[model samples]
Target: MKKITPANLVPLLTAALPEKDMAHILNALVQFLRDGGVKRASQRFDLLLDAFKQNPELAREFGTRFHRWLGSIHIYPALVGLGIFSRSGFAREMGIRIYERFMPSFKDLNNLRDVFLYLFQRQNDEKWLHTVSLLQWLSLYDTLCRHSDPAAVQTASRHLEQARLHALEMLSIWVAAEELEPEFTRLEPKLMEVDSAFVALHQEISRLVAHYRSGQTEHYDTAHIAVMMEQCRAQVERLRRKGTGAGAGSSVKVAHLLERLSQTLDRLAVLLDIQTAPDEKECRRHCVRLLNSLTTAAVEQHSTELLRRRSINMLAKSISENTSGHGEHYITRNKREYFAMLASAAGGGVIIALMAGNKIRITGLGLGDFTTAFLAGLNYGIGFMFIHIVGCTVATKQPAMTAARIAEHVEHKAGARALESKLAKLLIDVARSQAVAVFGNVVVAVIVASVVAAAVAAHTGAPMLDAHTAAYQFKSLQPFTQPTLWYAAIAGVWLFCSGIISGFYDNRADYLNLRKRLTVQPLLKRLLPARPRAFLADYLHRHYGSLAGNFIFGMLLGMTGWFGHLLGLPLDIRHVAFSSANLGYAAVSDHSGFLYFLLNLAFVLMIGAVNLVVSFSLALTVALRSRGARIESLSKLIDTLWLQIKANPLSLLFPVQPPAAAGGNGNGGNGSSANGKAKE
Candidate 1:
């Protein structure tokens, strides 16, 4: 038989191989490239490049087919590995198909880097290069997915997706290896030495791998793993530059070692939670795309990568932590929890009623504008804190935290219709929880305000508010007459902000090790006994976010009126509980008729609706955006919501059954039935 060489084999495969066996033939070609040694492989790769140079159509078919094969398998695994799965059958099958396709070829090729190098040298065209680079990336990914650590899978998937995007933008250039060689020659050989450097790097990486295999990963330095990998990568970079133009055949062993080193580094990076430079990954991706081209297809894949960059991972994780009921009991999961939520709201209403009556009386004392805001904020903040300490729920404050939880679910479950149904179930739980809380708040607020107003009247021989004050308070609650609804929405926005503040502080508590820091505080230890100081430290760590969120929310509400006065805008908050209490006071001060009293009561309910709806919508929007989730099919979601409502309308008003068990499939809506609460 004639000795196989690139010049004849390239033509023979194109002219003779059946189209049905393309993937098999490609696998064979990869094997042949691996076995042929560097000199022969380089010669064959160059001959194939010439063939592509001579026949553009043939080049396009090769590029297109190669691109199809590489991309065909990886989409599902990539998405699944990145935690971007819909968790549907489709996603699972995609991952399985990718695994099935790649696993069979794994043992046949010992060094994928050499195969990539062979392809990279002939990479003068974008289409061909894009295909080959994707194949190279898939090989690395396939190896990593069988591991135990989640970090490796996440990092690799993210890197691959980013690389694809970078390739599209940066690989469009006409890069000629012939032109690059002169530039390559100028770089120092000592720095570019592949043989010795790769061996050293390989041995170092193998040691780390051996440690992990032996369950001695604890001895590894996690922080410097990425740095070490980059240094090893530099060796592969030098050989990649030399290609066949200088002495490619001599570096086959280096390529083989480099592959092993790269794989080991990938596992170690995940084990240590060490991050790689995204910029470097992008550069590598562009290089691979160019290498795959080898003067073939020029088609550029559009950048479909989501803007949900890994930079937001920290922020998202914080929000997710707060939303998941992590020892805080915030999500409403069962029937017992639901009743507890209502009871808490009722308690909050009593506190809110007193706060409202006090704020009106204090503001009427003719204190300076700034002083009024400061005093009012103090009253509201302390009162809100009191309610929280007593385990009471504030109706509007639930959305911000719950939105994060819901968004997390959406991330794991992706299809539009599926997401819509999931949201509907969550919405049912949310709606019912809010309904009960609002019911509790409004009823108690009205009752408490009435009692407080009468008590003030008996003591001071005057109602809590004058006629002017009474009229203004009533108008504030009336949705149709003034900008009350808009102001309510503004208050809703503030509620959403408070949720973010709570989540931020919660995350900060963990990140800064607040309890540990507090425990060691010199003043705390010096002034207090060990046991007392430890107790105080633990308390602060657990309740700091709640204290902060409530205080800030109070300040926001109080300052809004003052800011509106300063700007001559009619801006003011209309919290449902507070507004309902105000309605009771206004009714008594004005001695309004029965009909007028009923109308005011109706207005208070409307105000509560505005407050809850606006706040929840804003919070959910932010939560979804933070996770890079955009549900484009609002109609479908609406339809699903309607179907759910139709199926169980009572669920929107009241949970028909007990909430699921704690940590069950509960909505995590209003949180647990625990005695403590986080409130706005």
Candidate 2:
């Protein structure tokens, strides 16, 4: 029994082909190229190419059969639209993905689009195609087309030429429309032109393609084609910048469209470059790139991974940018700003303490889980909203907000040294800001809750909490006895989600022009004079997202316990401020001894640590990815941070006295001036 390996298998297949049906053998070879792992496919392809070099007769027989097979199938759709703008809107594309998951489109073997879809439909299929080198890809393609009398091969070239022209025209229109978008126009009115570079570039490329179709041999002037393309590209970048800014109000749909337009321009530019190649060698290299793009594009379009990822990144970046306006205030760059954050967090803590007591009252009412959740949630929501209205900070919510500022800075090109310095400093500010906020919230909340409990007990001759409720609250906060850390992590996730909600609403505020709508609002008109109405509208415009996010976050926190009970799960949130406040009430009401209270206090701090760590890690991960920061840079950042930490550990808990301003007093005067400097 001979063990068949790639070493012997190819020769054996070649010998047996003489006695076998050529059509079946050819189909098997084609299938070999399409399927299997990269190494196996490469081995088989190399073997076939070697066999062809040795025998001309066999090569012709195989080549003719292959192209004849190719000539019979449709290739236009695959060439022109496979990974291009075949799908437009973000919602439509997502719907298509959802539909395909349940009920896929039927594949027609004769159509190249369907055939490509059929061959590489899996999410992981794009990996192998990307790893295949341009030289190997070129070798495989040239071999297939080598012995062709095939009209299909010629038709493919013609289709590519046609696609190039069409892409040029389509890109021009897309660019024109995007530049004319009100926001884009307003952002850069001076960049506009009469013979718009986009339209002119389209005309130039179309002319070049016409020359090739007619077989003209004269030198083509495409020097300015590159210049024109650059102009269009520059404009695209401007729109991207303006679109992602605060109040620019970009959507996933608009972001996706911007990405697709950029891609179309790139592919079109390559096509133009290929035609203007100086020699056969240059032309072949250009052709190799296109050949590689064709198959990779098919695989990508079928997988749809690239489009989905890029669209989401663009949207996430926009969301981060939108919310980052408030994030700057969350970061404290100096001593004055740091103290202000502590004060704000302390204010928030006082309200949270009262809210915790109300939650205790609500829970003791013996209501249904859903009804309990509703009332408790209402209490939480209105309380948090009141805190926001009065200008206070919640430590848990800072991660999502502060992450956007860090992300925006990562995108800046300030040279490697400056970036490292500024980034590390910014990180220090964020860390200290977080520390002070948590310290203020926890300590103040605990103190307030304890004092209130003592006051009630003194007046009413009994503690506010009954024995059972006090015991239950203590049990819930125990880290070792329960999955309390896991619960805290859940609370962190909710905090992150609330931040995203805040950003989305902030973007929507600008997108919907809420202030103008409110100015014309009928209710406002009836309630107040124009001067006062305008002021109220302006205030709501600024705080709309914060108000909505805080309210919804409260609801989520309130509902988790109910949902857990309904599903027979141990799911519940353990936010740090709330847990600390609960501890204060439980200790005072239960009349627990000092030793036992200290033990519970240790657990409360541990819970707070978990809550902050989980929320901050998630927020940072999303923010960095959305900004497309390189892994290399992130590694560098990690190294830089370690150096920074070793040099001055206190910097993470106290202000750095930024080196550039070291000679100066570095007091930062007051909170407002310090805040002005922290803005990116």
For all the candidates, what are their Cα RMSDs to the real structure?
A: 18.4, 4.4
Return model 2's CA RMSD, one decimal. 4.4
Error of 1 at 15 (Å): 39
The alpha-carbon deviation from the true structure for residue 403 of candidate 1, after best TM-score superposition, in angstroms, is: 1.3
Residue lDDT tens for model 2, 1-680: 65335456456556646643344464455566556565556655666566565656555666665555555666555545666654348778777766786888887777766666666655644555555667775675666566545675666555555655555555555555554555445445654655766667766766766776677878589887788889888877877886677876777766777777687777776666666778856766787787667666656664456667877776677778876777887887677787777888888899999999999889889898899999988998888788888878788888888887787787774456668767876787788888888888899999999999999999999998999889899999888879999999999998888888888888778766788889899988998999998998887777888888899999999999889989999899999999989999989999999999888888988988888788778877787788886334667777888887888787788776647665774545335632322211
- The CA lDDT of each predicted structure is 0.58, 0.74
Q: Write the per-residue lDDT of candidate 1 for residues 1-680, one digit (tens) a residue.
A: 57664356567658634565444556555555544454455545545555555555555555545444443333322211222212133334345535644552332112222233223222222323333336444333222233324453445445544433232222111111112322233332454444443344444444544564464424454334345456645744554433212112112222223333333333333322322223545544543433333222111111112112322333454454464343224445466777777778888888889899889878888999999998998898888777776777787777776676677677667765578887777767766766777888889998889888888889999987888899888777767768888888888888878877776666566545578889899888889998988899888777677778888898999899999999998888888888889988888778889899888888878777777777678777776776566666779878999987887676777667434533464545543443355343
Candidate 1: list runs displaced more than 4 Å. Answer: 1-287, 290-310, 324-333, 415-422, 630-637, 658-680
Question: After aligning candidate 2 to the native by TM-score, how far in Å is the CA of 444 from where it should be?
Answer: 2.1
Give me the runs in candidate 2 sitting further than 4 Å from their true place. 1-27, 34-36, 61-76, 97-125, 140-195, 209-215, 413-415, 418-422, 525-529, 593-596, 630-653, 656-661, 664-680
Q: Tell me the lDDT of model 1 at 520.
A: 91
